[model samples]
Target: MIKIVLLGAGNVATHLYKGFKKANTVNVVQWYNRNLKSIETYKNEVKITDNVNNLIEADVYIIAVNDDAIPELSSTLPFENRLVVHTSGSARLYDIDQKLYRGVFYPLQTFSKAVDLDFTTVPICIETLRKKDFKLLETLGQSLGCVTYKVNPKQRPALHLAAVFVNNFTNQIYRIAHEITEKQGAEFDILKPLITETARKVQEVSPYIAQTGPAKRNDKKTIKRHLKLLDNPDQEAIYKLMTESIKKTHGH
Candidate 1:
């Protein structure tokens, strides 16, 4: 069994804890957070502690806290030469104290504590300083039924930047759409099917091939009308920027 000690209480950490609990070959031996109350409820299931010195022996120690906190937490860990990994997409693998085995176990997906997550669907990006430790991390990821990939430092950061464009930036556009619909007294739910179809289409074909709308067709009249409909300068700017991007992409 791969015994893991997860240290963090955020969305990624919470979801990982729940996923690990369900994996038969994986055991979450302990959970650590600076704020004990954040993980107090899981004390009965596994050892929970706020003190770093109280950490028990485990096969892997996962630091899932904020990117800024990673270096300090890694430095403060009571032991060294143990396998230590962080669940950050952008943070450097070397962020962990060099005294311990440094590695990254980034999950390429947005996480929310309230949403149900299926581990099998999430891709685990693994990187390690020591070649010997790679297999152990791969096995750890596989334990949760996740598809594992050996992503290098450059590729990992590039993937993370692309993720921000796809997930975070796309979600912001959705929020903008919601606001526009609300101002027009239209039910935002009416656009849900279109949103679902857009997502589904990308899975089957390249986004370039899936492109549609006035911008893609180079309908200058419709584009002008959209810009005129927007009262907020920020909204107008975003609409213009997106339209220009789409036009440029389609070679308009």
Candidate 2:
């Protein structure tokens, strides 16, 4: 079995622990966090600890904490030359302490502690210093049923930036739409089908080809009406900016 020591109790850590536990080929031997209470509930299943000195002997140590804490926390690892990896999309692999082996095991998916994720659907991106260590991580990734990709440091940052545009920025637009609907006393639920269809269309066709609406059609009247409906200055600015961008992209 590929034994793992999971560090942190945040969303990514929680989901990873559950996913790995379900995979017969991998064993999560221990879970550690500075705040013991955050990981205490997992004690029934795996050995849990707060002190770094109490960490168990394991094949791999996976850090799933905040990005800023990675360098400092990694420096404190009492052991050396082990396969230590961090679960961050944007952090440089060099950020880990040079005294020990370091790598990245970034899952290209948004994690939520309350949400159950299908490991098979998540894209596991990995990079390691040694070729042998890469095989070890690849084996672990495949065991979890993920589609693994050997992504390097230089390319990883670009992927992370694109993810922010597609996932984070798009979600913010959804929030803006929800607020607009709610302000007019309309049920946001009514837009559910439209939202789903919009997503589905982009999956089957290029986003440019799937694009529609007043901005795409260069309907000035509708654009002016939308701007007028948006009472908030910030909302109006965003709407106007996006409308202009769409027009420029489509040559409207």
What TM-score against the true fold does each predicted structure earn? 0.98, 0.97
**Which residue window of length 10 is worst by lDDT in model 2?**
107-116
Evaluated at residue 141, the lDDT of candidate 2 is: 91
**Model 2 regions more than 4 Å off:** none
Give RMSD to native, each candidate.
Answer: 0.8, 1.1
Candidate 1, residue 7: how far the Cα is off, in Å: 0.9
- Candidate 1: deviation at residue 148, Å? 0.7
lDDT tens digits, residues 158-219, model 2?
Answer: 88998898899999999999999999899999999999999899889999999999999999
How many Å off is the CA of 187 in candidate 2?
1.1
Clashes of 2: 0
Name every residue pair that clashes in candidate 1.
Answer: none
- How far out, in Å, is residue 22 in model 1? 0.3
